[model samples]
Target: METGIRDIVLKWTAVVVAATWIIGCGGSATKPSPPPPAFPKAPAKKPSVTSPKKATQRPYKVGRNWYQPIPHAHGFTQKGIASWYGKKFHGRKTSNGEIYNMYAVTAAHKTLPMDTWVRVKNLDNNRSIDVRINDRGPFVRGRIIDLSYSAAKRIDMVGAGTARVEIFALGAAASGEPSSKRPPAFVPVDYNKGNFTFQVGAFKERKNAERLRQALDRRYKNAHISEYDSPDGLFFRVRVGRITDLAQAEAYEQILIEDGFNQAFIVAE
Candidate 1:
């Protein structure tokens, strides 16, 4: 006990060292697991493909004495004995490439376009009539307007066979004739010039023109064709619309170009 310190330290050191080693080796280390991957949401839808809401169209209802536009008729000037036509000539062809009817309350005026509307006031009885101008007549000179057979009876001019009257233009009027001419017909500066159509090309075949028409109908709703079968033969021609806005019309020209219509241009409707 007095002289051996090394022997006593070595005996206790082994037990402490062995215990530390056993305690440290008893525990095991664990590795961490990875997280799940995140998924992305789809993109938003665009607006171009959506369909537009349709508009409601209004119906026109009229009774008696309505003069609708008949392109066959135009021009007027007259002073004559107005005689009416009826019964036998009803539904017959008039001079202006249109059918005539006695019941329609129509009249005739020389040099005036067919399908014109005239207000005939009887000079004798002062009676009045609204007649559709379809036929042509009054071969005699010094007579300006001629009445359809029915028009003359309505105004009591048939019995006399002669009446003084006036012709009026309604809706869109032709040149020299108007409701009233306060604003000059010719405006040097065209502030309100409207868009119109033109025929850039023509074809003898209707099928070709129709195919072009279908491709343009959506962009140019007014786009159409006119058929003229001259003494020669049937001819089909493609025509763009009478669109009021020229700039808007230009936009359609681009569409036409994309659709393979090259030479397309604007024309008067």
Candidate 2:
């Protein structure tokens, strides 16, 4: 009886071992899962600057000079005397970081891209030439088109400090691409900080500016005094602030003018 029982037990153990081996072989056949797919990245783009866009470039009346606002469009046209600057400022960095060479066909415009190409026509002489804008200002009011000395020579404007002429953008840049603003229009930083301000009196007198600040505070609220050194190295600016509202600011400027702050202006902070 004992011998028969032992044989049965041995057979049952062997069967159990065989079943576990078969299950292990089946698990090996099932492989591991694959990874998920990745998404693609996009291309980068440049920044855009937003300034006032006029339907027609308006004539800017600065002092006695008639400033014509160049419309911020793909092309432009206008009439003015084209002149040039050379020698004294040659090899100097223009307003847009370009070296000034009177020998090159460059122009200075109060408003235009630094590297824009425009076809200038001397209406008096019936002569026309192309130029690139690399600098700013004829600063003498009542003038239009500041040409490089070479460009002026080419268009026969060397003799006359002023002339009658017309300018039209030709949409050609040195890079072999359609014309764009010479120095690509980059955004400027916000030039404002809220604080007590002082009114600038005649720039010549420091004491006068301080006196005005004290007087402004007596008439108004929270008026403090401070002097701002200008980049031009002339004139210390006085300001009256610690106030809000555009209308209030304009009214203050009028008051200062009335009180004989002749050069008094508002500093928007």
Candidate 3:
């Protein structure tokens, strides 16, 4: 009976040891604890940057002359002979790419920046006009400013062609408060009262005159070809718009110049 009891105890001990070994091997094969529950990676960061500002002023040249426009022209002042340009340059482009308008209060300067507003006083007559500088010119020596035909008329320089004048720069229009006053109205002249017209082009060849007339007709009203017998020879004149007064004629001339007819001028009927 004692031998049988001892054998039963040994069997139970062997069973317990085998069960412990099985549990240890199963836990070791548990997929390495699921790789510690993998997490997503973060994105990389980028650096910031900035750019430099552009320059506002630049130097330029025309013909034999070099010019450096003033970047800032406020408070600038000058005194010299101011000449007037009419029908000859009436319908042309200004230095600033604007259509030249002789009727508008505008002028041209050599060194003053474009779009500058200036007060011009005719020293001879004490007449003053406010003009915007929209072109570069008076390339002629001894001349300081080139006034538009209308500007010249304001200062009574139309008969003289030029006048001694004083000019004061008032800065850019954008930099100052806008004027509330309306611009001067263009007074129309009665066709029956006077004989005036804008001669846009003159050609010795009738065919050339006809071509210009056709071009002008497409862009302007009342464009026509008129024949003129000059001492040199017969010439064809391409005229546009009849006017009754010199002021009205000059205004039409300005329109032609802006249209690329640089030789356009006023003529009496």
Q: What is candidate 3's TM-score against the reference?
A: 0.45
Across residues 30-133, which tens digit of lDDT does each residue of candidate 1 receive? 85545432211222531121121121111111221111121222232334456555544554666554555444466665444444456677766677877655
Q: How accurate locally is residue 159 in candidate 2, as Cα lDDT from 0 to 100?
A: 64
Off by over 4 Å in 1: 1-78, 171-269
For candidate 3, give the lDDT: 0.60
Order of quality (TM-score): 3, 2, 1
Model 2, span 101-122: residue lDDT tens? 6666778787664555678898
Choose 2 or 3, whichever is better by lDDT: 3
Models 1 onward score TM values of 0.35, 0.41, 0.45
Write down the worst ten-residue block by lDDT for model 2.
Answer: 14-23
Q: Give the Cα lDDT of each candidate.
A: 0.46, 0.50, 0.60
Query: Which residues of candidate 3, in runs, are more than 4 Å off?
Result: 1-56, 175-269
Candidate 3, 16-118: lDDT as tens digits: 1110101111244645654432212221431111121122233344553334454446446889989877555655767766656566677888777666678
Clashing pairs in 3: 87-264, 90-257, 91-256, 91-257, 91-258, 92-257, 92-258
Cα error, candidate 1, residue 221 (Å): 44
